[model samples]
Target: MATSRTGLDEEFIGRLETSLDIYGIRQDPSLPPLQQTYMTVRAGQDGSAGSARLALPAFKGDKGDPGDGFLWQGDRTSAELAALREALGTDQRNWAYRNSDNNDLWVWIGSRFVISPDAFGAEGPEGPAPILVGGTVTVNGEALDQPLGTRVVGSDGVYSLGVDLPELPKGEPGDQGEPGSIFSSPDITGGPTDGQILVFDNESGKMVWRDGYLGPKVYNVPASAFGDWSSGLTGTRHIITAITIPAQPYRYRLDFDGSVEVSSILGQTVDVQVRADDPDTGAMVGVAYGNMEATGWVNQRFHAYSPDPFTPDTTGIRVGVVEPGVEQTLHVVAVKSAGLAAAWRVAGNGRSSLRVKLERMP
Candidate 1:
């Protein structure tokens, strides 16, 4: 009743013998005698010699010489590989690599770097052309004069084929808008008078026309107006001249330019002041001071005004504000400081005239 090697009996015997030996059945002998007998009978029926070995433990062989195969030095760039090659000259066994710039791998084959072909696979079949669902062509919103090709997302939220759009036509003319307000518009209240300018009125929130140029206004005081002050006039203040500033919406800057002949003892000083007062309330708005220090009959040019008039809450003179239709007055006054009993006088002549500059501020 021996079964040939060609049959399932032989195959079953071979597999069972391998499993028994792998489970250490031969060394341990833990199986019952009935099962052991059954295994022996099956092997005999399959015509396999009972003396044949199944899964014997492999014997350890002697260690061989170091391999002549390529040694993986580690990943390196092209420059690094070149340096390494120069340091550790070409041996057939050295290997180093860097990822290729393209989708391949660069390997150092000891002598020089070469691109490996293992990174690429066989060419795949061509894929079907992307189905274009739909798209839109727009103009007037932006200038796309040249034909543009772009991928568009369909309503289904998937990106389809790229759509090539031709140069779009110009959009139809839009409805005419209402005309905008000009200088003659009724929104601007006031004159079309000569030498008038358009200015915004914050109180009325409208544009207004006012007489005069928008630049600084200059006022020159005649030399005859600056009368001479005789000697022995110490501890006294004399009025030089008064300037009237017309009512306006903005604050004003007052600057002064003048010269005076000081007849005084050495080291004595004469001080001058420019003061602004509200004509209606008589309230002192601001004041600026200047001085001249000299000996007998010394003519000195003086620029008398606050260092910075536009700054508010400052220690010195500040910008002056005039109410609408109410004029402001600026007075130039000179004072001789008390000193030695020596008599002195500040004389004003043709060169002693004052020039006052008024600038409009926002």
Candidate 2:
């Protein structure tokens, strides 16, 4: 070694240092030559030619076609590539493309997406729809929050704001929509009972009844006869008053009261009774009775119910008192009924009064 740097050595060493960017190299040199090749020059002497095998990089074949509407944009960053892939997978309506360097991967969307004036005004699909950039839309001289993407439709050319419109002032309600059909008393049938109110049923379109008054009916019986019973009286039972009950079968609740003044008849037992009897047969229908020891005055209150669906006597009802046999003046005071007609005796000498009230349970 004369310490001379040979051309081969110089060239070989120089080639190794310089970076070379190669593409489209054959993977298998053993097979027939492809559209690529490898180049070299002879190096050794002495009738024995030597060769220096060029170390080749990993073979990479030609890139396949990028397919329709797409071009290879070189290598892409993971984030950019991921975003592109995501946009593609998310919605087919999304149109994404890139420049040659695969940077700033831009996404394109159809006109029907988001709110835009151009999309709103798009009448046909033949032309490239308008693009949405920084800008708001206004309609009818009022700026819109956002342009409505929906196709504007209607003969009058009214455009939808596509946003919540401010609530409008409510208009004055149109005069009371005429009045509902009037209902009259005569319109109802089966004459409503006393104290029964009328009501209109909207569903049935008819007049109906709520109910008749349910309170107890009171009848006043004025005293017609009042006097102390003399010992010589003909009978033990003295009729104080009588009320006429209609022959109709009606349930009745009879309430009565009577007061009698007795003098010097202490410890004497006196009886008072409200009796309903048939004036025709002199038979009793129903009776409520009470008794009290004679003193200065005896007050009695009695109540009775006729048999269920009780029918009153055909003639009338009689309220009377059973006198105590002795020398005592029995001044009959008052008798009252809650469910029968008024009946009483006006005694000039004594206080006699009876009141009856009649109620129909049926």
Best by lDDT: 1
Give candidate 1's error at residue 246 in angstroms. Answer: 3.1
Q: What pairs collide in candidate 1?
A: none
Give per-residue CA lDDT, model 2, range 58-145, as digits (tens): 4447767864452323434446545654445334444443432323444434332221112122245454443433344455556666
Q: If scored against the real structure, what TM-score would every candidate get?
A: 0.36, 0.31
Candidate 2 TM-score over all chains jointly: 0.31
Off by over 4 Å in 2: 1-170, 174-210, 227-234, 245-252, 258-270, 277-297, 305-351, 359-362
The CA root-mean-square deviation of candidate 2, after full C-alpha superposition on the true structure, stands at 20.4
Query: What overall lDDT goes with each candidate model?
Result: 0.56, 0.40
Against the correct fold, how does model 1 do in TM-score? 0.36
lDDT, candidate 1, 163-184, per-residue tens:
6777577678999999986766
